[model samples]
Target: MSTIQFTFAVFLLMTCSSRVHSQICEAGWFGSKCQFQCHCTSPCHSITGQCQGKSTCLKGWFGNACQYRDLAHVSSCNIVLNPRQPFSSWVTDRNDSTCNEDVTLESVALSWSTSVPFTWMRLTLNESVILRSLRVSFTSKTSSNATCIDTKLYLINNKTVDIRCKVIVDTTSVIIEGQGVKSLCSLYINGGRNVALKQNSAQTSTYTSPTVAASASKAVDGNTLGLLSSNTCMRTQSSDTCPNWNVTFDQSQVLTAIHIYNTNDAFPVCSGRCGLQLNKFSLESFNSSGTVFRYQDHSTTFTSLYEVTVAEMASGIPVNGLRLGLNRTNPILMMCEVEAYGECVPGSWGLECKKICADRCSSQCHVETGSCPVCNDFDDRSSCHTGCATGYFGYDCSQPCSQNCQNRECNSTTGLCFSCVDGYLGPDCPENVTENIEDHLLILITGLGVGLGVSCAVIASLLIVIIYLIGRGKQPLKESKPSPDYIQRDSIGTGTMDSHGYQIYVTPVRPYQNVSNTYIKVIGDAEVIQPPDTYINVTTKANDEHDDC
Candidate 1:
């Protein structure tokens, strides 16, 4: 007993120590003992070692554990289209075991559109999904006939029927027309897990024989035998009439694509044996609103798969229910499985809900995409991520922040400035104003005094120059009289000479008082040579007097 007690005590201590170690390791480390380390630079969950936060996980690591090195990433949105995931129709009698082609309805067959003549079954889904590719599993049955390929398959969404055979034809599958998104495929269907659904017809020509009825459910049942059940089985009815249904959803679901499964590969003859397998039948959806409206009216010959899932368009309204139509009288409208695809998640929206919605979206967003069709007061138009534009903050981005905030920008929700621009401080950014009138006044006075001094100096200089000029003008010029010998030399007659260093006298100078000075001074020596035919003047005047010569 003593040994057992000691052993138990040791075990308890070991267990407690292990638990503490697991809780004590930092985010980046992981191990049984919390002694091992993870290489991811981002902080991970202590036990799981998964990096988290707004930023993505470190490169070379992925997944919740950050343990994968592969580049493959998983999508959070549900994009695959599976008919067995709890889909409901407006008028279903029994939810048969239709997940595979081998399953069948035991006692009840959900029939629709008999009284109203509309072949459509109001459909609803469990989750909102942007429809991807749809692969309908047809009920499988063996048949010796070869006329089963004549049946046509199609999809009608809210009174609009897509008939582009290239998009989705035959009794199998459909891709949305115009691409992956041609209309708003968002649907609000019943919540939680979906129940199995199968549509029934009111026609009396249904192959009542057990041989024909035994394989009817094989088209929708997921059978491992493949084409054996698909080649001969078809849900048949005598008359192709109205299946008026109003499918209401407990939750909102988005739909973008539709896929129908019929036993097209069946070799059985197409003489009403296969109700869903018909040569010419139309799939239609009834419009609950509006008296006059137009919808998809395109048509084409069907092949094997009728896929209508490739377009980028939006529906005018989020579809509440759909209708099915057949043009031929007493035509068989048989089907094994039906699949609906769309993007109508509550938190998300869009064709596939591929685009994420803004955080501040108030209510329903764009049904075909996750973009916010409407936002809160301060929310952004594209995304409600930011409450308001710059310089505005607080609830709904209604309150104004300080303009002095650095770069004139501030937090979108809070008005506090990271820093002021200039001349302000504190949370409210008060102005840095002060009085400096006294200093400015002193500077102005000094400038005025300097200007006055300069003006006085200029005036004094101008007055002195004026006084000097006036006084000098009053003085008279002093002149000396020429000598009698100089007058005798000048009285001699001047002669004209030609060329070679000789002077020519046009007329001798005659003296006059106050004459203009225009005399040419002679260079070198001057000599008197009397010549005939030359004129000379005898009167002379001094240069000191104003004289002309």
Candidate 2:
């Protein structure tokens, strides 16, 4: 009992206590006491039970601790499995949804003489399941040299995963083909489930009945029994207006399909139970961001389940709520069950919602593919990512520009033309100004021609009148000579008369005032002419009063 012996004993005791406190559990289990099971899409942390890397918890489970579970999980244990080829002895009852302990398939050894493409033992699941990863054990009963076996995973989402050994799995079923191996055994899945199971659900009105429980939550209770005795169907209150049923998930989810189990009660079999009232109903999805996405109308009458697939997830918004109602006011609405299958995590897409979207993706990425939804303009509807081509504009580039547009070019968003050709005007280049201008010119020319014709006619009439008056005034005067007594001649030095003056004759002028100034002496038919010096251009009367001597 020395100081050294006591100190060593205390240290050894402390080491044993620490080792007992932190005992390790197997791969899929974690907790302070190593008691909780993990269902992460990726590997879970040993201490905290959280999903590691960039992965998330499987659908129906959430939170940092991954302890909270929702109703979205649908187990594949009891689902039926059928082989693609009938009468194949390879498949048996052991090939059910639950992977058996000793189930295995045997294949022949690889050789050129053997069948070229080996046959695959394909099994189709009666119900689809969302899958993350799958593992299958392989063994050889004989000497086989193949190190790897090929496996194919087919999803109900129309996607395929082909890989070697343990890899990414899919929904619905798996197809297996052995290489040079002899046997393949037991299947194992990591993660996948439904997101809308047992979530908060409501309807416009519940049926007022004392004998039955017909609340809206009955539609999503994972029960498809349509009988009235089962009491699993949801019945709305009878009214003249259409009734609506909605289910809201705790978190946003990207959905693939929504299955509605129509009412099929047998006791008092009515038209509603036969899915007559289920026809002509529409489905709408509400996103967490307050956006509602609508689907086309459903008109088919089914005896059992009717599936509606929401294909376009390009809007990028994760759905939080779903609404299903009749298009017409059919009095009452009765639904046996409703199931929604999809990924519950946002900002992630693709198989199992395991892939993260790119940073450049705006709003939301497509659920199947990580590609962003772009090309809102008309030019590129199929990922062209360009503006609308010439002569096309508006959404989807379906609208054509006006033919009068110059070079057939216009705004890609709006149909407004850049410029009008020739005489066309306005934004759409629909108005023609050339025709108006031509019409005005024709009117002006006609007016000018009429005015010129009238002016010419008036001028010609005035000239004709002037000519007639001049001719009437110029008519020859009556021939009358002065009387013989008036003729007197004198030979004076003053030269008043001609030198030889036997007789003098004077002629009168009329109209135009020009007088004859010639003096002639007549003696027995002989006439005498006046000298040049005595000749004068007279402008006076023809009578004697005009004479100046």
Most accurate candidate by lDDT: 2
| Estimated TM-score for each candidate | 0.28, 0.35
Q: lDDT of candidate 1?
A: 0.34
Candidate 2's error at 400, in angstroms? 63
Task: Report the C-alpha lDDT of model 1 over 109-178, residue by residue, as the tens digit.
Answer: 1111111011111122222211221111211122111121111111222221111111111112111111
Model 1 / residue 469 / CA error / Å = 59
Model 2 residue 456 lDDT? 64
Return the top candidate by TM-score: 2
Off by over 4 Å in 2: 1-192, 266-274, 290-293, 312-317, 346-549
lDDT tens digits by residue: candidate 2, 313-348: 322236787887754544467788887755534367
